[model samples]
Target chain A: MADVVKFDEHPSDTLRAGANFNLAGIDPASTPGYSGDKGAGESLLSELDGKLTQLQEQLFAESRTGGKKRVLLVLQAMDTAGKGGIVNHVMGQMNPQGVQFKAFKAPTPEEQSYDFLWRIEKEVPAAGMVGVFDRSHYEDVLIHRVHRWADAVELDRRYRAINEFEARQTAAGTKIIKVMLHISRDEQQQRLLARLEDPSKRWKYSGNDLKERAFWDDYMDAYQAAFERTSSEHAPWHVIPANKKWYARIAVQQLLLDALNGLALQWPVPEIDVDMERELVRRS
Target chain B: MADVVKFDEHPSDTLRAGANFNLAGIDPASTPGYSGDKGAGESLLSELDGKLTQLQEQLFAESRTGGKKRVLLVLQAMDTAGKGGIVNHVMGQMNPQGVQFKAFKAPTPEEQSYDFLWRIEKEVPAAGMVGVFDRSHYEDVLIHRVHRWADAVELDRRYRAINEFEARQTAAGTKIIKVMLHISRDEQQQRLLARLEDPSKRWKYSGNDLKERAFWDDYMDAYQAAFERTSSEHAPWHVIPANKKWYARIAVQQLLLDALNGLALQWPVPEIDVDMERELVRRS
Candidate 1:
């Protein structure tokens, strides 16, 4: 697998299940892909801008035609884990028209009435586009298991259901990149404190965040189990150590580039008579 | 009414009914408040970036506190009239977390089952947020009326329902800025041709675009009636001359700033003691 086509930051297959994919073993502060400072990351980001935009444009251009594949970057992270930052910095660099961002907050009454994957399925990216899910169906397993809302059997069933759901998306034309932005317990505390002190950031500080922090160990355990049950080659999870925000962002950008580059996308051909259309436009 | 506040480019009340507001009199090629080229407009946009970003952050921060108000910039335009451009260039300058952008397409089977405003009401920006509806409930009137999908009475009723809906939203702390991005017929032809010729843009073209062009006069008439019937003091529609895309973008940005300025919004105070929270976070 390592000998395959390169990603500047190839997602570690260590994240692949039944392998050594333990959440605890991975240090949150490590920068796995690049040894760049913020300035270097920003510069690299600038360089990738045109390529990323072009790739996205081609993908959108080809979509709705037959044999189109889309990318769904499913972002799962603990609260205050820079999910929004990635959306702003990395994904923001792309054409907003070509991308879809759905930040799934707590489900609504209407959403709760349906099964978990029902809402998730409705939001899958259309062919030839990039779809981003801030928190995804995995919330069902992670939070539900952490809170003991689901029994072991039901939990096992949901993991199976998630695997089946993702498999179907792949069978059709969706490449799923499930990224877990891994931050340590102490780092999260610093982030929470930062949010509390800054009036601008204070509103984002929810009382539930504090309560959620108390369950940190439980959440970690749930995440470990999730990897054990759900990670696969088809929908592989990349556990990106995210303590340095810049590294997490660059790693995610590389993941998207790898996915898009693998597609061998082409600029779509004109289905209409271009010369005639150009003449008409000239005449008008 | 004009004495209370200022907008760098205040929206024209010529769009208001029983006033000078008439669709045909306004030339689409005219730049209403701007006397600048694209370069100049881009510079102005850059200058406004920090202010807009700050205002949006304050708006979002002020929200969740009681008595907070929100802004909903309802954008209605003819196809290819630069709605997406305004979204990416103007509103995109703000915090994406604080702004909700919903491009309302054709209603689905489930959506058609309910009232036109049902799905709309679901996506209204929470307090302190700025919501952009690319094509809103107005579509039920614009496209529907142009095609005679609804009869005279039904059409009249939908307009009334829309006005009432705006009133309700205004009563509940949502300030509505309804804008019509008015582009000339020839401009549409040019834009459509550009899309057809450019491979990257080809995907955006549709056969229906030509079908729709055939009904241009009818759409113009439909829009005239829509303005006369529905533009209210509670929610005024700004008819922006959009053939000059730069002017349209700047004007929209100014309108948003005016809306935020009118609020006299302050940063929210903490419900709990800030000092205690800081101490607690320090301890943690």
Candidate 2:
């Protein structure tokens, strides 16, 4: 049996709410809280699966019984930082009924006409759901900042808007988990090259990805600014070094596990009289 | 290694659209088209996982590149018939990004105000996606007939409306797989009792389930009426005997596999200049 990995300090604590956090300072290949090789990390993830499923079901049960709590996992990452992999391998473990997934692409004509958060607010998870945003409202700040689509004043205004938006959601009982899957520029190049070489993966590649690569430093600066501005006690930002796919997967899973664990979810008490219902079933 | 299970006649063929179909005549406990025991059936399901994943990814890739084809799995069943089990065990194996899951409850006031298909139309799978409906528009006819909520004329109109709705979706490139998970009344009684006995599963139990159980024969008739009127060549209904949970799971998995296989999906060819992009990526 693989020894259960325990962390004296939670992965969330190590990764969350950086005051003077430097995105460039973290090594993309490092596994922060896990003391394991790839094999051990993979085994640990399999172990976490059962616990995650149970917690999610309990959360979903709460929803059915008029619980308002929900979780939003905001995943902001560079291309090939394994956002899709995390969604498939991690969120996919739970009942898909309880998972609402939306991948926000560039704004359409109608979408651009509305506030950035307009399209986002429409997709918020209902009571007792885990909503996964592949790329989110953060993009308005990140890409828009790097490309100078919005002036500095407008960009600064977005930061406040985001803070207020998240605060409002938090007040409404949304547990927000914001993560930046940190990857080195070199790692992205290798992964892009791999996609280019493999015909099956070529659908994910675009010349626009390379064009964006030229703005790497600008993107990083924008991310740093966004993190400093938006990281709050209610919703904090966790920067996971994601050069190693296995580590990123487990680390993100652990962050979600920590969040659900904090909810102290009880199986909602049976609302119906069990004895009476059982008798009726038996008679039927 | 588990030997791959090959069916000379697909499970879809054995379980689909019947002119003389009798729901009561079919044995709920029978595992049609599958000659394996529970262990073997499970092993075969595991084997089907990789192929399903690959096919779903190809379908999703097609969606990304402007392919409009999609699949919708419509599941209608009596309470405790393992519809949730099939979703958790089978559909959960695919990428959540590509799977749109909706569990329709009794229509709310807003939903009731519109034509039944209005709510359902809004949830249809986009291009290259698989949409699963736990209980669907069929309920308007089933429960309405059982409870006398609608007169015979209204029910007849609903049948025509359903047929036209499905035909329109089919013409719009939606491959519809309609299924009824048939379970014996005895099996349902046992399952409901089991839920009542297990504290952890009590949330899934309800007093209303027993009330519905009292109307078993009427429901079977409603289901029979539905299968007859709405089973079209473009969209056929398949009734699977679901007494054995393992068999139902693998049977549903196989049905999905057959639908995807019929598509004969090819990997979407890369739209970008591969050589130029590769050079750019290498330089970056």
The candidate that achieves the highest DockQ relative to the unseen native structure: 2
Off by over 4 Å in 1: A1-8, A11-18, A66-68, A106-119, A126-129, A278-284, B1-8, B12-18, B62-68, B106-129, B147-154
Per-candidate Cα lDDT values, in order, are: 0.82, 0.90
By summed lDDT, which 10 consecutive residues of candidate 1 chain B come out lowest?
Answer: B1-10
| Every model: Cα RMSD to truth | 5.1, 1.4
- Tell me the lDDT of model 1 at B239: 89
- Clashing residue pairs, candidate 2? none
Those runs of model 2 whose alpha carbons end farther than 4 Å from true positions after fitting are A1-8, B1-8
lDDT of 2 at B210: 82
lDDT, candidate 2, equals: 0.90
Worst 10 residues of 1 chain A by lDDT: A1-10
TM-scores for all candidates: the values are: 0.86, 0.98
lDDT tens readout by residue for model 2, B1-284: 55656554577999986788777788999988877788788888888898999999999998888888899999999999999999999999999999999999999999999988899999999999999999999999999899999999999999999999999998998999999999999999999999999877998988888888899999999999999899889899999999999888888998899899898888888777888888878887
